[model samples]
Target: MLEEFVSLGKWWLPNNPEVVVPGKLSFSPVSGAKLELIGSFYSSQFEEIGQVEGIELPSDFVSIEENFNLTSRVRIDFIKPEEIIILGLLDNNEEITLYRCSGRMKSFEFVKNRPNLLFNIACIFRKIHFQDEQNIKLKSISVQYSHLEQWIGKSGIQAVILEEENKIWISYQPPSNIHLTKIGSLDLNITFSPINVNPFDFYLGATYYKANIEQKTYLTIQNPGNQPLDECINLLISFRDLLSFAMTKPTSVISVTGKTDVIQTKPIEQANGSITLKEELRETQVIIMFGLWNSEKNSETKLSPNEMLFLFSDVENSLGEVFETWIKKRETYESVFDLLMTTMYTPSLYLHYGLINIIQALEAYHTSKYEGIYQDKKVYEKGLYKKFLEVLKDFPSESVDNENGISDEFRNALKGKLKSQTRFTLETRLKEILSEIFCLLPPNFIGSLEARGLFARKASETRNALTHHDKEKRKKAGKGQELVQLFHTLTVILQICLLRELNIPDDSIKILVERNRVYQKEWRPSSN
Candidate 1:
């Protein structure tokens, strides 16, 4: 056995071959090599332990692995106390096997030798295995649904289904207090069947549907499956009944405040009401309770402050035309549309998470369109490599050779050592890639090159802060309103980028971007 040697540095191994000893337990005079070990490696007897008497054995265990204790005593050359020394065993073949020691350094002693100082080190190795077994633990899981209230219809009602043990529970919750007059006329039911087992169906009639006079009522359906509940189960709901229940609304009175008088009005709720078609319409007070009222020309109607109504037949038609065109190029725009819709429909509370998702979606779309261009060896070497080098030139040096009075050759060697191992930070890398990609956009589309660069930097910083939970940076990134503006800005820019990659007409893209409310914000468009 050869005497064990030690290597020391910030990292486990040094990159400088000149400093490393070849086929021997020796090294060059390095300042960070605080200590060296000279000893023979030895192990104590191996011990086997059986299970406790009358205890059940684990199915996976046949026999417990033997445990042994390893110990070594070596002469430690204590060059510096603060620097850490990692000891390893060097074999006759010059192979170094480092010890995975959990024990701390102990029992330090000084040996006098003037400039050639050393210390006595006695390292102890203990083998202890502590395994924790718990009966139960809580885990967070995500739930996915096919439809949300806002996307389907603005009914303000949501349905969520959760699984526990062998039962599937479906609950329909209302946002506010409202009467369900059609509760008696409606049929509420749930059909649950495990695919692995026979069909298990459950139904609830109008009598089972519960409701209160003033407060909203929650309807729940619980169906126990015949088989054990796995991680996920296929669930289907009868949408006809659910949609009918969602579309019906309770009648309410409206009060209007006038300059001199207060007017209270009641709406006529007819079970079966019919309206005659008219070609022309004048400016008049016409209140629509429910159902579509079609018109060829525009007519203005006064509405209450809190009344929510949408008048966008023309806008809808225009958007439908654009969507039809996009569908023609579905492969180009489908992913972008999916992510954009997800961001748009994200709940207000999780807008930050939504922003991050949109950013990822942008990156994905960019890679999908231009990955070949970036990954081509010839193109990369000729174009992007030079650009990458230019960006790398701006990175600050992280040299570690100034403290000792070393020779110029060593200094230059260390400088080259630092340069060879240098790499760009994540933020710098993202900014460079984004800047290069955005350069392909139409000229002046994203303002100046400086603007593009700033966009990448800001976007990367905000994303990193949000991801790494840098509270100070995140707080300074923006308030809720500012984040909303930033979110809209990012979404619009990504949409535009996707369209441009699809080779859509610039005029059509401009029209789409300008007409959308998300792009109408005051925030300037940037690469982020």
Candidate 2:
């Protein structure tokens, strides 16, 4: 792995591999790049001899000796290792080798014997490829959706079970029928590929040792049309977001590696300063998810942390369809998805913000899913606020732009209220969202909010109290643990709402939410 990461000081183009420059490649999880390259600062030595044309020197050596000194940045091509070649096609139909070579002239030296220029570049990439391929078409990519192993429960290494019947001893070995499972569309499939293990038996004079096949689930994504690498990465991230929401934990990306079609003759061997992948090389964070149960995919045995909101195995059959539907509405669900993820990712994050975020997410989801107005747009803008604006237009403009006047000050205040005027209040949206999602939850999961008449109004009070720091209003809001519970309850509601957005059915959503260990234990229900 280290060998794959370290590159010798040089790089070049595939079409023109001869012109090599002095540079080094660097990338990794902990050791991302602060790259550097050095080039000769002055070409005076060559110029003092003669000018070069098609050949190294002039046809007539006596033409002139032009002195080339260090004045500006020098442009040079570099060499890439011949074994692993990669190419990227641009939108303009021009093809180019992909390189993450980004750096600017750092310093030029005037020292004796050795004077050179330096370049400092940052080579870490997350959202886009370094070459700015815009939308790079990738054949396939490998990613580890964290905690997926525990969820899949399909590691072929099964325990050897022993049984005794009618005084006779017998052994019952768990079946080894594990195979790769593929899900999702033909153009894009999510494959749960199991690692291969060799089965062997070793025998000594009086004893024999049988080797069991060890298996761990591997995840790979395929894009038939060679979809953009960035999109594929987003798909990986989005699916992970779904997992994180389902598990109620911050599940970081485990590992990522991509490959172009091997038939393209550019099988990545050791990509130096580029995203080029070779031999399935990877840089990932320390292992965070571990196996809880030792069983294969076909086995009914599975385990999950009590904290998980829902187990992947429970909804997996429907997940391909769920993910397919969910991701298509990225733009529509971006706000709610981000807010939900933010709460999940940052567990110690301020609870006040979490409450506010979920509430905002509810508002955003409702706003997108259903369209309504507190007052019709024309009625409010033209009939309502317009009357105020008209009256203000006749009045003197804001005197000195201060708030104490009935001029532009009042006018601006009314305009500020315009956007919210037609939208549902935080309280109205909260009740509306809860009313719909509560029907999808287990019976009295959070008790009957309508009968108790406490959750929604108190939530609105708390949101406004914390947001505006309203001391008087704070009297009605929850304190400390109560506030945290409010936030937790709201987080649960948003999770269910998002599942509904994925077209998960009402009864299924109810069962899934009830199965949550935290939902069963931690949440406090409204009193009857």
Which ranges in model 1 have alpha carbons more than 4 Å from their true place? Answer: 1-338, 372-447, 471-481, 500-504, 517-519, 525-528
lDDT per residue (tens digit) for residues 449-495 in model 2: 76324677778888889889989999988788778777777777887
Residue 49, candidate 2: alpha-carbon lDDT: 30
TM-score of 2: 0.66
What's the CA error at residue 528 for candidate 2, in Å? 14
Cα-lDDT of candidate 2: 0.54
Tens digit of per-residue lDDT, candidate 1, span 225-265: 22211211111112211221121111111110001111234
Error of 2 at 392 (Å): 4.4
